[model samples]
Every structure is written in structure tokens, then in C-alpha cells.
Target: MASGTGSTEDRSYTERLTRLGGARWKQVLDVQAPYRWNLRRHLGGRTVLDVGCGIGRNLQHLDPSSVGVDHNAESVGLCREAGLRAITTDELESSEEMIPGRFDALLAAHLLEHLPEGAAADVLRPYLRFLAPGARLVFICPQQRGFRSDATHTVYFDDDLLARTMREIGGEVVDQSSFPFPRAAGPWFTYNEFVTVGRLADRR
Candidate 1:
């Protein structure tokens, strides 16, 4: 859910993302609110790099040292307003002297569905090269119900596809699950997500 300022729809998405975690219903079920405390155990004390971190929703749940990178300037601005650490992907890439090459973990929640087939792989491949050996990479893909709930989503991924993508991109699948609720609840809500965890392979 990175920023894309191409058309009217992308602009609308920015507005929606900015308010996603503010709503009463979204606070209980949205990606940021639900995962805040629950994800701490898995993250341990590592510095996380969150890709496409829109409005810093999930960042609120992560460790204070975590950093977020997004394509949308508005999203990064919103995060800054909330006192969260964030940078545009463009800024990170341009100022190569400032960005870190490695991190303890990487997270992409509700992000991949926006990319086309093979494109998701493309986004993740480079990060794999810089991760600490055996570092963790977690992804949350939408199920059918959640996929249809958003107009921006471009692909669907069940467990099989998620696992396949991880393996193909040089990650070892560690865990896969339907989180916070069952698949049956997906249609009625927007929070249900397919969680997939993978570890970087030993490059040594």
C-alpha cells in the first residue's frame, strides 16, 4: 500500500489509508491495530524495515527503532506527523550514503496484493540480498474476501502461492496461518489476512 499519485483512484486510496486505522471498526480489525501487540513476540528486538508502510499503521505496533519506507509522500508525511520514523523509497534509494544495507527483519503487510504476478518477487528479491543471515521476512496476503474488498488489489494468494513465492525468492517458509479470524469471516470484514513467515537462507 505504498503511495501512487497517478490517478484519482490512487488519491482516493491515500485518503482511505490515512483514515483506515482511525475508524472504530478498523481499529479492531485493520492491519495496524490488530497486529500491534501480537507481532511483538515474533519480532523480538530486531530493527525492522517495513516496505510500503502506508501511514505507519503497522509501525505503531513495531519496536520504536523500526523504520518504514513508502512510495507515497502523503503516507510518509502522515507517519512523520504521528512521530514515527519513515522515508520515501525514492529518498532511501537516492541517498545511498544514508540508508542501511541490512536489517534484522522485513515486513510487508497488505502490500503484495497490489503488485502483479512476478512483480512481488521483484520487489522482495533485492532486500533478500541485504538481510542478515537467517533474518526473518514476514508477509500478509489477503484472502478472497479481503482481496475483493479493495479496488487496488491486483492479485490473490492462498497459502500455496504465498509459500511458492517465498521459496522462489530465496526464502525458507517458516509459518503460514489464517490470522485473527477464520476464512469464513473474511467476506464480512476487511481485517482477515494470510500471514506467511520466511527466513533468509544461509549465504555463507
Candidate 2:
């Protein structure tokens, strides 16, 4: 529901990204290969909701029942081609249309930093309503070095800030770590990855 300046431009960029075949697509897959491997190891058999699933790159790592949502129509088409259920929307405008039942797990890789700080919180707020009693939310973003690649990224979070924000948003910080890979280093020295688990408070 949050409006931004570059909807048209974002759609164009997503369209171009969708056309990336051969080596370009391979490069993307290569960059994501390690993360996908890690996710599979940690998140198999869990019903996952992948927000901003670009080109379905993470589909192979998740279970078949997983659902992916993005703002790009082209990306949604590609996800369908890869045999994953996908939905396209303009932005986090309508949670009712995109988010349905409670999910066992949620994945938001490289997505949080793209929105403005307040918008990021808005995007995450609705997901809380749909989570099962003890669902886990896995959030991955560029720690410091990874922030410059896209102009759309509005805010960057380190491990401490990420953990603090997750706790404030009613999720318990269950696990946290740094993602190591060969990439351009940034001020933070490492990209922080977090896995937060949600819990339902027992009635008195």
C-alpha cells in the first residue's frame, strides 16, 4: 500500500532481469547457489512463503507446496515455468490478496533492504497475522557491502539491529550468523543472516 517513485522503472528492471538467460542467469544462480543450499538444509518439508521471489531462484531449495510472491509479472511467469505457485502485485499494498493462511516458515531474502525503513516494517507487519503458532521467518539482506548494488535499497541492517528489530516485531531471535561468500566487502565485514522464530503466548 505504500507508494513509491519508481514503479514503472522497477517493472522495467524486473522485465530485463527476466530476459536474462544463458550466462547472465547462470551468474545469478551461482551467486545464490550457496544460500539455496543452506536454505534447503535448514528448511526442507516446511511450507514456506517466499516474498519477492525473483525469477524463482529459490524454488529448487524449497518444498513443492511453497508459494512465491513478487511484484513482477515476468518473474511470476518464470516461477510458474519452474513449477512454483507465484503471484504478482504492485507493492505491499494488499495483504488480503497475497497473504492467506498461516505458513510454517517465511523467506524474505534480500528484500527488506529494498524498502524504506518504515515501509520495510509495514511489509513485514501483515505477515505476523498469518503465521502459525511457532512459525519461523528467515530474513537475508546485504549487511553493508551488499547495499550499493541497487539504487532501490533504502536501509541496511547489521546483525544487532536486525535482531533488535525482530524482537520488537514479536519474534524471538532463535539463531543468527554471518553469510560468508566471495563478494565485494563492505563496512560491516560480513553480511548478517538471521532466523527468527515466532511463538504464541499462552492464555492465562
Candidate 3:
């Protein structure tokens, strides 16, 4: 799955993406999206916090109790418009009451590469507090070619870097691997992802 479908947060992107992933179109695409259905099954009944959830793409397959958070107000509006539960990053940070509860899992799919190393750490630490002890943390970042595809992406993560980043944030790495396909796929949408699965080590 792709991260910010639009690099910038603006109504212009909202207007464009709305047409691109509008109701009718989403209905057809959601069912066909790869890996998400199995991901739903893997999640079982756990509630998830989807960080950087753009336009609620990942929300479609997660549990109904999942809450999506985005920095983009327009994207959050679009998610709410589609009857999905979501909140803005400002709202989430402005008050502790906004978080529904400790989530069983956290998803930051295709998100981390956008920030510098230190900024990424700063952004992730706060979210860890909202996770239940032993909660699973799943991180997906671009590999090589995919990293170059988006001009906004500032960093590239191989397996080691992803593991180190998670460990630095107090996560115990459980699995680290290149996903969906081999590295031959090139880092592009519908192809490669450096997937790291970890668990919060009772930090809360």
C-alpha cells in the first residue's frame, strides 16, 4: 500500500483524491487490494491505530474499532465523510481524551521515510504510549526504487535500519523482512516493502 497519495496536505489534493478513490471506486478496489485481507485476518479482533492513514485506505480492511489519524485535515474529513472513524493529528495531540483507548496494534504503513531520522523518533515515541503492553507495532517503509519514486521521501530504510529505529523507540523486533515479493520487484507501489514487526516492551 502507498503512503500519502498526495505529497502535500491541501484541499486541492483532497478534491483530486476524492475523485480518484471516491465511493464507487473504493468499493471495487478494496476487495482486490493485495495483502490487506490477510492482514485483517491476522489482526483478528484487535483494535488498531493507523498513523498517517491517508483517505482511510488501510482502515477498510482493519477492524471496525480501528481509529485512523492523519496530519492532513482534509484527509481526515474525507475519511469521516465516508463514515470511517478518524481524527486529525492536532486533535490527537491537543488532548488525551481523543484517543479511544490503548490500541492492540499500531500501523505506520509507508510513513517513516518521509521524515529525517530524529524527527521520526520524536513522532513515534508519543504514539507508543497509547499502545497496550505487548501491543504489536508494524512499520512499512520504502526500499530503494520506491524511495526514489516520491520526491517527498527523505530517507530509505533497509531491514537493519528499520530494526534499529524500532529498537530505539523501545520496541522489541519480532520479525524483519522484505515483503509481498522479492527485492527484484523494485520499491514501488504493488511491490516491495521493508516490513518490520515488533512489540512494545511494557513501556506504558
Candidate 4:
């Protein structure tokens, strides 16, 4: 069962994001390093807008010039506490970083799967205007095995699904790849993900 829009924005959802299996132990081991570096490799711009920033896991690894946005206020707060810039959806337009063509890239790590069929397009359309005409857009969605790990995931956004959603948002799909493993590994590896890169079509 998938969570409703409200449930995904709840504090409990944010709480679950913090369940990284003993924070101190995980930090000491730096288990997220490879994945963090993997994500960092995709973003090569000075400024990025990280939608669905979720506790700043991805945001923390991005450049300081990046700004994050999530519907979960608590997650936004936690991001700020960790010295990352983040804001809730409500503060988006008014945010100082919302200037036209303000960002060079946009990121939505593990975000689209949480949205139902048409929601990904709706969610991404508005943000495209804030990005430069040819700014990069990266949508990272979990593969089959990783999808089942979260009850909140509404739909699985595989390569085809992601390409469709990106087209709807006026983006040009440039590439798609299985990160840290081959496509075959997705169904068995919990963290295996599809990294889709798109360029916002020249809206000007």
C-alpha cells in the first residue's frame, strides 16, 4: 500500500529517514560514502535545487551553493541544522534562491517514485522555470528491490516511466544508467537505482 500525500509529508516519514542503522556506527563506518560520491559525480554545477531533499542526505553531499526543498518541514529543519540550505514547498517561490534561471542543475533523488502516475510531471514542471534553459535535471529512482523497502513508494519509475515523466515536463532525456551495479542487480540489491539525466528544454 502506498502512503497518501499527507502521510508522506508527516514527521514520521522524516523519522524513518533517520533510521540509518545506528547513526554513530554508520557515520564512523561512513557507509554512505560511495553512494554520496556517486550522486556528487552527476552534479557538476555551482548551484543546484534539490527537490525532495529528505533530511539532506543528498544535499549534504552537494555544493554549498545548492538549495533543497521538501514537503517535510522537519526534514527541512534538519537540513538547516546540518548547515545545508533547505526550504519547505510553501516557502519555495518566496525563497531567495527562486530567481529565474537561478540554478544550474536540479536533483530529485528517490523522489519521483513517491508520486503517483501523473504527479511527477506536475511536481517537476514548476521547478523547471527556475532552472536555466538548458540546466541539467537528474531523477534518481529506486529499482525493484529497493522500491519494496519503502512503504511510501507509490509507483516504480523505471527507465521508461522516467523518460515519459521527463518528456511531460519538457525535458530531453540524454542518458539513463544503473548506478553502482548493472540492471540485473537491481532486483536483488536494495540500494540499486536508475539514474536518469535530462536537460530542461529551452523554454526561452
List TM-score per model, in order: 0.85, 0.75, 0.82, 0.92
How well is each residue in 1-204 modelled by candidate 1, as lDDT tens digits? 222223312456679876655777755665454566556766758778888898887887787878888878888887889998888867876644234446778898878887766688888775665467788888887776678767677778778878988888888999887877877776676668788898878777
lDDT of 4 by residue, 1-204 (tens): 344343678888888888763489888988788788777788954589999999998898888999999999999999999999999999987888788898989998989888886788898888887898888889998898988888778888889988998888888899999988999999899989899998888877
Q: Residue pairs in steric clash, candidate 1? A: none
Q: Which candidate leads in lDDT? A: 4
Query: Residue 198 CA error for candidate 2 (Å)?
Result: 6.6
User: Compared to the true structure, candidate 3 yields what TM-score?
Assistant: 0.82
Deviation in Å, model 1, residue 62 alpha carbon: 0.9
Best candidate per TM-score, number?
A: 4
Residue pairs in clash, model 3: 146-187
Error of 3 at 32 (Å): 4.7
Off by over 4 Å in 4: 1-6, 21-25
TM-score of 4: 0.92
Cα displacement (Å) at residue 129, model 4: 1.3
Question: Is 1 or 2 the stronger prediction by lDDT?
Answer: 1
What C-alpha lDDT, on a 0 to 100 scale, does residue 195 get in candidate 2?
36
